[model samples]
Target: MFGWHVPAPDQAMLISGGKSRGEAGLPFRIVTGHGAFVVPVMRRVTYLTLSLMESVIEEACVTQQGIGLAVKGVIAFKVGSDQASIAAAAQRFLADQDRMSVLTGQIFAGHLRSIVGSMTVEDIIRERQKLAEQVLEASKLEMANLGLVVDSLQIQSIDDRGSGYINSLAAPHQAAIQQAAKIAQAQADQAAAEAQQASAQKQSEFARATAVKQAEYQSEIDQAQATAQQSGPLAEAKAQQAVLEEQAKVAAKNAELREAELVAEVVKPAQAEAERIRLLAQADADRTKLSAQASAAEGRIALDQAIIAQLPQMMQAAADGLANANLTILNGTDGLNDAVAQLAAQGSTILQTVMQGLAAHHDVGQQGGAGDRTDPPALGPGPDDDAAR
Candidate 1:
């Protein structure tokens, strides 16, 4: 392990002054990717970088038109991954590897000037990639001789050395782009303004239509209110008139009813009382007629009884007078008997006379003459008294 030599992933280890030798018969043996053993005092060891390296070249050159220009470019180069190239780079730059970028820049600077010299300033500016490719092509063999390989080349810029040539070439294109942008912006603004004007017109028309409709509606409302105002008092007056007519009908009906009530309460009762008085008077008249007839009949009966009672006393007085009479007896007994028979006949005549007188008195009383009609007339003595004397 003490005599072992190792290289980095980006480096190659070289060993010299030992039994091991390179494939190209060089003094050093190249080893990469792994370790190698060497005699510690006998072998001399070194390392060479195999990684990417950059070289920037900026140079003043003349174009084909004899115009002075400044050229700037960058080259990406590295050591070739081969035993021959590794041996060549080791023989030349192993002791001074830091100078690789400096020597590479010097090498590409000469090639950039040579390539730019064959082209005009316009050609270099318009075809910068072409210029970089040509420069890289011309330097490829020379770099390989140094054991370096060119990976890519880029032309950064080409200037006309304060002549204002590039700015003048691009001025027309910049103006065209600016003009297109201005036109597009103006079109957009015009469209927005037209749309705003159309919206404003529509709003104004709507406001006008709304105002017209509101005015018509208000007019109709006012007309209806006026009609109602005119009709109010007339309708009320008609209603009051109807009510008064009904009240009058009621009053008339009441008057008729009162008239009928008067007939029932006052007139009917007065007629009934008048009829009762007439009936009472007729009854009293009939009773008086009956009492008068009964009294007349009783008086006639009492007078007849008193007359019969007086007739018996009158017969006794006549018989006693006949007993006291003085008389001569010439056929005395026969004459006496004839006289008695004559007396009896005289009595019968006397009774007939008294009955005739009573009949005449009763007839006079029945004519309603002025007399005490309760009593009978008095009787007198009979005829035939003178013939007895």
Candidate 2:
């Protein structure tokens, strides 16, 4: 009494004495002549209805890792698009539902394995509906060739329990970056504060050094003024001492000049009078020399006058003797007169006869022949001769 859930072929049987053969053996007729004879009887009747719905059902006892997926789906199929393939696939694939269902489940499982490896947990959960549609479209071509169809696919839930571990591991790295940023900002602020303090200290030291220099300059000015006041009276006394020395030198020079003028007036005239007396003594010596020359000229004139008085008498006596000796002394004037007197008086009387004879022989020219006659020898002196002698 179990009614078959799948449909089967229909047939009828008729029994008389023997069975029909050939075309008559078939219970159904191609022509409409035997239709009434194959009708079902009341007690022996049977008809089976096989489903034409294209969904293939499969049951799996899978022990997989717990990915938490719950899904239900339906795929529609027909015998292939050609009639020849329809008959072949209907005979081969329709003979058992378990083999066809196992093949279709393997196709769906392959799509799920690829999606799981490539997609993250969040992507799979958020896009579950789109994931089912993509799997259904990919499985349709192979399933349809075996007279199977995919109608609709459904994804009830997708869950990722590993997301908690991913978020927990990232927290420490984020905190480390924030801590480093804060430490860098603190170092920058500290350096700026140190630089400002150093600048202020330098300005303060410069102001103190300038104040010390100004105080020293004022002290030096005060010392210079005090020294000038103490030395003023000493400089004035030295100038007065120089003026007194110049006045003493001028007074001594004036006394020397007055003494020299008195000597020139008194001594020069006395020297001129003494020179005049010496010239008068020289004139008296010249007058005595002229008086001696005049006395000597008078003595020479008297000697000459005495010699002139005796010259004529001596000349007369020389003439008389020359005449008596027959030698004529032709003395001028007085000698001639005395010689003539002697010849005239004595020569006439005493020698006249001898003179005449001498004259007569001379006149007869016999005197030239006359012999060298010697005068008679001197007779004795007469009284007159002796007396004249």
Q: Please give each candidate's TM-score.
A: 0.50, 0.25
Error of 2 at 176 (Å): 25
Question: 1-389, model 2: which lDDT tens digit per residue?
Answer: 23212223221122222233214343322211122233223212222112334443332211133343333345543333333333334445544645555676678766655555555444555677776777777777776666555556665444333444324444576677667777777776777777777777777777777777777777777776676676677666766766776766676677667666656765666667677777776776555444433433332233234333433433344344454555445777877677667645554454455445544533333222223222222223345642364
Lowest lDDT block of 10, candidate 1: 365-374
State in Å the error of residue 32, model 2. 19
Clashing pairs in 1: none
Cα lDDT of model 2 overall?
0.48
Residue-wise lDDT of candidate 1 within 190-231, one digit each (tens)?
877877887788788888888988898899889889878987
Best by lDDT: 1
Give per-residue lDDT, candidate 1, residue 38.
84
Candidate 1's TM-score reads 0.50
lDDT of the structure predicted as candidate 1 = 0.81
